[model samples]
Target: MDKILEAVVMSSYPNNVKQGLVRRVIEAAKQPMDSEQCWSMLELSTKLYLLGDTKYKREIGKEVLEVYGHYHPEEFEEFFNVRFLLSLLQEGYGPLGKRSHYVLDYIQLGLQFVLESPSANSIFGLLRIEVLRKVCERPSPKQCAKISKLLIQHPQCIPVGKHQVLFCQQLIRCIRQFQCVSEGEEDIMEFLEQVNKVSGLLQRIWRTQTSVILPSLKELFTIISSTETRNDLMYLVFLVTNIFIAGAHPCLAEEQEAPSNALASVVQFVPLELMDGVIRNLTNDDSITDVQMMTAIGR
Candidate 1:
């Protein structure tokens, strides 16, 4: 029934087509329908007018969202809003494929909506992560810092399963870019951001019980552990791991009761031969040692 009515709205009307399309949806939205149909009609109405500069679409969209909110308010609102904003992004791309400010606003609004709503665990976080990755690719330092920091704090922003692998890959790419592009003081700051990003990634590992992130983790370790690599990067990775470890450094005995110590988990992940080489290289280098790191190793 809903589909048949939707087809009516979607079909061409000879006169006052725009207003007619919207009127039909509003009439449909007022009818008795299932939750899905109610939501769909609302979205269809938005499609007709959201891009208009006037309050025309906004008012109708709000009414539809409100009506849907009466059924499964939180989930329905967020789901519909995300889809609507993504559509705007699709339409906002310019003739030359450059990101338009219109789209940026949509992205920002979408992210804000995600932040304000309850998480469906990592589902929303992944959406936020994808958005952040898009922003980072364009390399807006200010926007990157803002969004990354927000994602770091979001419990759902955890890098796990496939995301853990993706997070590491992107971090490695970021580090490589840092190496090529940074110089002097800018180098130091960018390196610090990378370090924090690594630490932010670290938070995800605790909940991750499987060896899923291992391959990419090893790749990251290889880069940071290599002797030819910069000292700050090495120290950053070490610091990140130490910070993420389960127990406080001073209370070794207290930490020992758990069979799965964070330090041990990491130790088990690193191949023994690679570990030896990293230790061997560190011995020959003048890089500063992290005392907390030794404690984690001791654990």
Candidate 2:
């Protein structure tokens, strides 16, 4: 048993470990291995050793950054794997509080890797959106600006995913909400300009045959309308109205406009009375609560 355990440990580190035997051993050990044991194994791995010391860690981090920073599609899977491992380590070290600075350092390193990589802009754009969703439960203006910049710079990078629209909508909603609270009109305007810029890029991508996984115009409209602020409503109206004037389909354009804005425009009109009627009905419904409102918009 002792010899077998030693062999397993030794084999685990060897580059040429027999896949069948390794799999069998790992499966057998799974039930008995506690967190400490698992961590010990991880620590013993070459990957962890590389991650442990500052100089070596930095070198690895630099390599990863180079891969991700340049928009290298070939390195996507490798970067994702490394990022996943780093995230796991970050989570593992969280209970240590301030002592977890090293974990954060590693995370920052991982981020740097993403930031410095060739295909980084898109990857970072996606990552920033995800990070913002969690960090911006109630975001600051700076965070909003940062996210806005990302969206503006790498609009096509945002892949079509279940959460993509929700993240975009949430970010816009948060920026609008922040604007309302702080009366930051300039900030709001800046954000809107970026949003519009990104929207235009998305439109161009939509029109192109060679476009990568860009979000559809309908998806953008869905997100814009789903945001949870009066200001967001106004902005949505503005965006839709502009898109309509740009010669997009009237129906699709009208979908994002506020009832008032839609009614005001002859080019793409919806009746104000009907809009008010819908709003009145929505207001009267107790089931249309705040949570429901967010859920509805998110959908």
Clashing pairs in 1: none
Q: Give the residue spans of candidate 2 off by over 4 A.
A: 1-129, 135-138, 155-159, 180-299
In Å, residue 118's CA in model 2 sits off its true spot by 8.7
lDDT by residue (tens digit), candidate 1, 201-293: 443543353354455554454443433422222233353366445322211212222211122223334445455656565455454356423
Q: Residue 6 CA error for candidate 1 (Å)?
A: 33
What C-alpha lDDT do the candidate models reach, one value each? 0.44, 0.40
lDDT of 1 at 288: 31
Q: Alpha-carbon error at 32 in model 2, in Å?
A: 49
> All candidates' TM-scores?
0.37, 0.30
* lDDT by residue (tens digit), candidate 2, 101-131: 3433434444443444565555555454454
